[model samples]
Target: MIKGNLAGRMGRMGRMAGDSGPERVLVAASFANRVGNGLFNAASALYFTLVVGLPAAQVGAALTVAGVIGLFAGVPGGHLADRRGARPVMMAALAVQAVSMAALVLVESWAALTVVATVDQIAAGAGGAAWGALVVRVGGERPAVFRAKLRTFVNLGVVLGTVGAGLALAADTRGAYVVLILGNAASFALCAVLLLLLPRYPVLEAPPRRRRWPVVADRPFLAFTALYGAMGLQYPVVSLLLPIWISGHTEAPRWTVAALFAVNSLFCVLMQTGIGSRIESLHDGGLAFRTAGLLFLVSCPMMALAAYTPVWAAAGLVLAAVFVHSLGEVWESSAAFALGFGLAPDHAQGQYQGVFGLGFSAGQALAPAILTTVVLGLGATGWLLLAVLFAALGAVGPSLARWGARTRPQPAVAAEATG
Candidate 1:
């Protein structure tokens, strides 16, 4: 009797743990993926400009090419994710990324870097579609719960990766580039392993012979895509150019930028789930998007003004900007994730995510060149202008919210076939 009682008790505990098993696995895998990518972001510019002796503009140009290519890559990537289920697509893409990262570290030539960047981003685009769609599928109507959990893990990973890179830079580690690349490759492998623990789910495939770009014909959907894309464009300003501005204008240690970013990531990890859930629950997601957008507008000009203020005050401004920007990210991301699945039929989730990727690709691709030119030519004032552009994106969000409210829900099979 005692043996049976103990066995029953243990079984209950096992079920309790297993209930969260898939969600936890997805979150852990996402965390590793973000951490590895964060290292690449932290180190890549220095690797190219200082180590490889390439011009900054040249590096930006390469990213531009990658971004443009991603525009085309999205269709197939999204389609595959929906058609093939998230597991295989994510695993295969991560595998490719692992190979690419390894090559990037070993081959340091400009030719090699360019090739790696191109291939890596293509794989990344595919993986991103799968990841986003999987989040929706796994979380169902509560995408906020999943996204927040994922974001928290993502932030943790970013913190680890950035802090680690800061340490490498401080030590002037000889194999710093190799360390970053190898770390990225390992992270991808970990993502695969973590994903393996999740329950198997079918991929959401689009109908046979469905054409690409037709998604744009859905006006409300297109507006949502554009708004989300604009938000992504602002990320370069936050992550890439903002650091450059800090380095040039202040006596702040280079690692301080990473540190500030780490702080922001930590906060995001803590708050994203709650904030994302709240926003998703709103009857009008656009209102939440607008609030987030306005916050960013208020914050962006402060980034540029930090240069003119007292050094201590400038530091405060940068921190404030980071906080606000992170909030905007949470809002925008929550709406985007929720709508991507909510608006589509089960079968079309893949295409919807893919179509969304096109806008993101365009925005990110243009950001490097545009921000670099603005900072170089006009300095801080240029960034302020960029902020205004971001703020303006809020106007579009309301339309999307209204569209969300008004769009006619299609029959399930037609929704699947159309997607």
Candidate 2:
């Protein structure tokens, strides 16, 4: 009876989440891909330092260099998606990543490590571009709903992979590391195979793919991307800044950081898709974004107060802060995905999403330094200012999305321009 009930519930969820044929395929493949990513990231540093015997410093340096080098990958990948279609580009990119990931087991020196890492980084950059293009290709018209479900599944995959990583770490043997690495590579390979099983979207016949960046030419889109990038700072804020502030400046126990992060992650995993599904159109996207800004306004000040509170008070406030912060993130992300996908000309999805990716990427790359300088360098008042900053920036989303609606191309026009 329990098994049947479980199966029945799962079926109902699939229906609600739009897990139709292609959507299910995309979610399955994405879940597989994220599992590999989580496993590799969890093990990569340990694999390099402990198993491969490279110095930890060299590993960090190589990865940093590779990250810098890989920054250029998304734009060209997008153009290729426009020319060759999303599936082929995604499959080829995944194949490259799989090979590169497996090759990590063979690295003995920094030079070799750098080479392999760079190849992997390039593939990752291209793969991310291709992945975005594939989502656009597969989801069609109203993808935010599908994407929300996909993101939720992706988080579940990460949780599963992280558990695998923890078990590997507990085993603490070179052999265990090798298994983890190979297993991650295999997951990537399997995901590519599954992607191959999905329906293909041929490049709609169009004018030669433009070499010029369309996103840059569109001013409102650029502004929106910039603001979206700042909003994305919530990531570093939640992960890095809050933890650092609590440990260094507040009365909260050090372990409290872990507890708070658990809450944040679990909240996101539970609520992200539900929030993401609500963004049906441009106006809905605007409403979500605006709503996100208001939530940020609430959360930011709560976090700021943690600096001086008693242990019990601090712990409770931080929980409240992150709960609000997590919701803001859901709204911001759902809105951004809708806007990012919605604002572009259809033929240029690869390029557009690539550029749109810049917003989030910039936040990831820059937020640590920016947040650290603000929260620590400037002191408590900095928190108040940050609250205002986040709120103000978020407030801009609805209007910007509204503006995008005015200039966004008609579906027929976008289709023909590509033709």
Candidate 3:
């Protein structure tokens, strides 16, 4: 049943981007890139701690500081893409990433590690913004749907990479870890080369008299970003808080954490495109966000209640909660793609996406400390409060979206009339 469903969905995605050479190239590059990322993510911490001999606390602190610094890279990166063209900027970012990843091999101390990690994170942020702009050029009429398809391939690639990483983990040797790191570096180089095959997109010149940072001055979009960031709290809930919550608070086996992650990944691979297809407009995006919030509300309490259940029941409840949460994740992701792409002007997609990325990055960075305090320290009540937060964000999403839409300059309308 799963195979049939996935195959059918894959078929639909293929037809959606039929005969688009750039789209195919982009998907292949993204898949390759993600596979490398998965390998690095799985083994990098162990490599740093065990092989490089950095203290775990120091490693965490360095990464946190690096992430904070990297947050500032997006806007400049996007602006550069707008000025110099996204394709070349994206290739440049990938090249930097390849160099940074390769340089990781030379890091023997905390300071070296921090420097390398910070550089890699900045490149990633910039590359992401440029990639968003490139997608806008290549994604034909429905970029969100195309991005959803890309995400499906991304999940598949990550799964494949993680499976490969398992071998290195089992080996538990410096040689194996080095191989993983080098493999990731090679993938970045490969991605850069592949991007060269893409057609050059013309750089969009900003209008005379436009503000230097229009997105910063856009109040309604910023409000939307805030709510989107709030919705993104689900990420750390799954990645950080849930595992701790399951292990320390609930009677469910420790392995349930892995099981839940597997469920979420599988759901994304099979269902993302389908859900994304439904979110074609800002109104649809708003509705999707609301639905996601409500689903999270349902799942959060179920997760909390699992702490009080019997062993078998606790496991069952947690599994169900994760399933529900995965549904919400799919909806939230699809909605975000729609709103993020739809609300932005065609010429400013890079900068707009860069600005939009800030919210998610901020949520990811803050979620660890905030969730640990609220969900872990405060317990079930904290979960309820979190649920209320998501619900409120969802409740207001439509109004926020409408306001953004109303405020946007109707360049498309003028172009349409002139054409």
Candidate 4:
């Protein structure tokens, strides 16, 4: 009987991975989209500097400006998705991305680059909001689990795309770069086409006499966003701060940075679905967030200690710390999927998701400067402080999630019955 139960559970998991036709289509679309993103991420800087003859500083400045401008697009785009329908908005955004990527091949000047980049960023922000809403509709009962499955495929696609990028980077010619850019553009077009295969979702109706900007007015959700944003510092800690620390401060080889990244990615691909499957409720999510925070506490100190160790010891310590950090990342991400989806009203998922994304994006924008000043500047003391901050944020997650849940709008029937 135990063996039979285990086999049945495995079968259920298999079904969950691609339960519906729309879910499978969405997964394919997400994979195709991320593959292009991976290629662009690996090669865009080199292409702009070497092939297009643009200065590095100008490129950075343009990208920063574009990121800042793009932040505003999510809210309005999500609102539109709520009103018009997520599927149509998502297709429109993908179409815009395709056009913007094609335009990048023509960019020769900073002005041209900035304009095209800004448009691309805006489209990306809008599309992200629509995607979140669509996921809610397509995922049926277990959206978070489905999202986890999608992330696994997304990582695989990126790995594949990076391999393609490696060939382009090796060629190191204008033609190769142009081909890379066009490939990304084509991917976006293809993703849009794939999205068309999914069934159309009907527009969700808002509550009668609802606030004009209900998500904006949701203080509990806003508070949760702030905490989530604070915890998001973990991202830059891994990507930006650790590399600098490894190269300049630790006795470890520079190659450790790449190894650590690969470790993190592999962990995500392998473990994300399992972790997400476990966190099925807000309570589970809150606990997972707390667990992530505690893990961060343990890992951060180990990372700090790496700077003081000998070469071999430093490498071992850094590797161990990153392993813990990656586990925390999986837990934290699972918690986010649960809370981000659970706290919002059914009709306004797009708006709520957009607002939630604002916090993450804002944190991302600020993380580089913050990490440089705090962790890099202060050394061991900085790492401890950041760890404490993450723990504190995680510790409060349950209470704040409870608050958000309490504030959620009731169903029309329930409200009418209460009245």
Candidate 1 to truth, TM: 0.82
**TM-score of each predicted structure versus truth:** 0.82, 0.92, 0.94, 0.93
Candidate 4 lDDT tens digits, 1-419? 99999999988855745788898899889889889988888999999998888999999999999999999889889888999999999999999999999999999999999999999999989988988999989988778888888888888889888889999999998898888888899899999999999987888787799886888788977887888888999998888899998998999998899889888888888998878887866667778889999999899999999989999999999989999999999899999988888777778989888888888999999999999996789999999998998898889978876676566655522432342
TM-score winner, 2 or 4: 4
Q: What value does the lDDT take at residue 284 in candidate 1?
A: 41
RMSD of each: 5.4, 3.3, 3.5, 4.1
- Residue pairs that clash (backbone atoms under 3 angstroms), model 1: 82-204, 85-203
Question: What is the C-alpha lDDT profile of model 3 across 1-419, one tens digit per residue?
Answer: 99999999998767644338899899989999999988989999999999989899999988988899889898889988988899999999999999999999999988988999999989989988999988888886778888888888899889889989999999999999999999999999999999999998788777888887788888877888888887889988888888999999999998899899899889889898778877877777888888999999999999999999999999999989999999999999988888888877777888998998888899878888899987778899999998988888888877876776667678643432342
Task: Give the alpha-carbon lDDT of every model.
Answer: 0.72, 0.81, 0.87, 0.87
* 163-187 per-residue lDDT for model 2 (tens digits): 7888999999998888888888888
List where candidate 2 sits over 4 angstroms from the true fold.
1-7, 207-213, 410-419
